[model samples]
Target: MKKKIVLAYSGGLDTSVLLSWIKETYDAEVIAFCANIGQDDELKGLNAKAKKTGALKIYVDDLQEEFAKDFIFPMMQAGAIYEGQYFLGTSIARPLIAKRMVEIAKAEGATAIGHGATGKGNDQVRFELTTAALAPDLEIIAPWRDERFRTQFPGRAEMIAYCEEKKIPIQASAKKPFSMDRNLLHISYEAGILEDPWFNAGDVKYRDYFTTLSVFPEDAPDKAEYVVLDFDKGNCVAVNSKPMNPLQVMKALNKLGGKHGVGRVDMVENRFVGMKSRGVYETPGGAILHFAHRQIESLTMDREVMHLRDSLIPEYAKLVYNGFWYAPERLALQALVTESQKNVSGTVRVKLYKGGIHAAGRQSQFSLYNPHIATMEADPTKAYNQDDATGFIHLNGLRLRVNSQVNGPANIGG
Candidate 1:
């Protein structure tokens, strides 16, 4: 029996061609696996296409619920926003896809696993590192990095030409000079025309190939939609008081939030490999969850704990965004994030309208909010001490005063 290979296939232009390339080059049986992480209609007819394109069999797993509850909710809890704008939407999905691909490779007794991630992008690192962590023995085949693949197809236009020569059916539309990746979590646009940082998407006369701008929200809906997220040990359990599977809740929120245009991010972020790149993302469900989770934390977490974690949020975000989801430092920080959320078990009410998700109210069995101590207009017997301020300010500013007098008044460096 010939040694077999399993590919992480998407049935897209690149993966479609990769299927044939792998089969011809290795003379091995190619088993393609697709994970349905909320990709919707994109998964339809993928099996047929894979079979026709030369795959012996195609495996498509529905991982939407697992993706939301396991991957996305943790990111939201950790406040894992990349560079404070890009939400690590695409970054989080790669590990899950690659992890499963490795599992399939093991089950099939395949000696190798292949992916369509390009050479010059972050997905290659995200996919390969995950494969390394999960199945180090299995050889990874990245076609874009391969000398033969590069020579045969050096660019997108050449890939398209090969697709046409091979009689692969490709849909034609209004010309779009950019590439987009869409999953259940979000849709990201980059490369080609979008590589230009100053190119206004709205100014362009062409239509987007993979995303629908018509779904964008601006005018407010007539009524506000209120959602309640149930968190247990930092994972969301329910939405809108309904006991739902995690993936189901994400799907529900995606529909609800997409209509209102909740999660859209555009930014220029520094890449892990040391280049700044421009990207636009749509993360409707994720934005709503993060906003609501932070609201509940504000009412539950201790002030000092919250402040300390808030200071480290950027670092935590950086770790996840940089593809260290399984790294030791990230796991250690996750332990801290989870510990702080022990009492974060509760329901948070959020109001969604227009493009923003606002926390309407929050309640927790372990809530630290108290009316007596929190109210500012209360009587003298409140939670804070008024006389303590006299010594507090002087003690805190003692070094500041001495340093200013000694080294030119109010000198910061002193």
Candidate 2:
């Protein structure tokens, strides 16, 4: 019996060629799997295309709800942002796709899983690490890392020529300036023209290259728009008083945020692969949700718990970005993060204006923000005693006073 390989196929130029190449090179039957995590029209005609490209069968699963609920929501709750700017839109999607790919491999009795992610990129780590964590025995076939494959297709031009020779239908051309990966959470652009870190997307010559889910801030509406998000246990449950499931919440927010150009990030980030790469992303809905989630957290979460979780944000973000979603450390951090959100049920009103997200108001049934205790006016209720602060300050400053005396007044200004 021929060995079977389940390939992560996107029906894009790289994967289109990969599907055919894997079958011919390995002398194996290739099964194509595409996870439909909010790709919208990108999922169209993939089944036919995959089979025509030599796939024995194709599995295109609709994973949007699972993506939003199981993947995107938990990441948001943990406030996992890569390098403090990236929302981890692309990073978070990898584990879910790889998880499904592993399942398909097991179900089909395939001995290996294949991906088109280049060896130089983070997705290669993300996809392979996920497979390693889940199913260590299954072999991972990365064509881009294969010397024979690289030799044959040195660049996009070669790939296109190979496609034409094979009579494989592909929409890619040499003139295309960048590559994009879009799921429901975001659309990320990198490579090609984006490889130049100094290239300005705002320039009139290149203005049209970067946007998909959002308009440029300069093109947004003149007036600010207000959006109210309702959360239960840190999950966004509604938008503007309309109850919605996780999927609906994302869709609604994406539309609102896109209109105001709320989530466009262009940054150079250190990839887990030990290289800095430039990435441009549009995460309209995610920005609104992250801001609103933090606002709600501020109103409801305990002080110490919030601080502790905040300290773990960078570590958690690194694990996710580096493809350790199923690792024990990440799971342990997730447990703590989940506990911190128990009281984080609330509503947050946000103002969106030309790429800015502002927390206008936030309220919760479990709100810890006591306005009466915080007020400066005469406190007839005496909710907080002003006299107690004098003693508290004195005790806290005792060490400082002793250090100053012993150190000869700390040599002010040297």
Cα deviation at 20, candidate 1, in Å, is 0.9
Worst ten-residue run, lDDT, model 2?
202-211
Candidate 2 pairs with clashing backbones: none
Model 1 spans with C-alpha error above 4 angstroms: 164-175, 202-214, 219-224, 379-382, 412-414
Best by TM-score: 2
Cα lDDT for residue 59, candidate 2: 98
Model 2 TM: 0.97
* Predicted candidate 1 versus true structure: per-residue lDDT over 78-148, tens digit per residue: 87777678778788988888888888888888999998887778888888887777788989888889999
lDDT of 2 by residue, 23-140 (tens): 9999999999999998889989998899889899999999999999999999999988988899999999999999999999999999999999998889999999999999999999
Each candidate's lDDT (Cα)?
A: 0.80, 0.92
Q: TM-score per candidate, in order?
A: 0.91, 0.97
Cα displacement (angstroms), candidate 1, residue 169, comes to 5.0
TM accuracy, model 1: 0.91
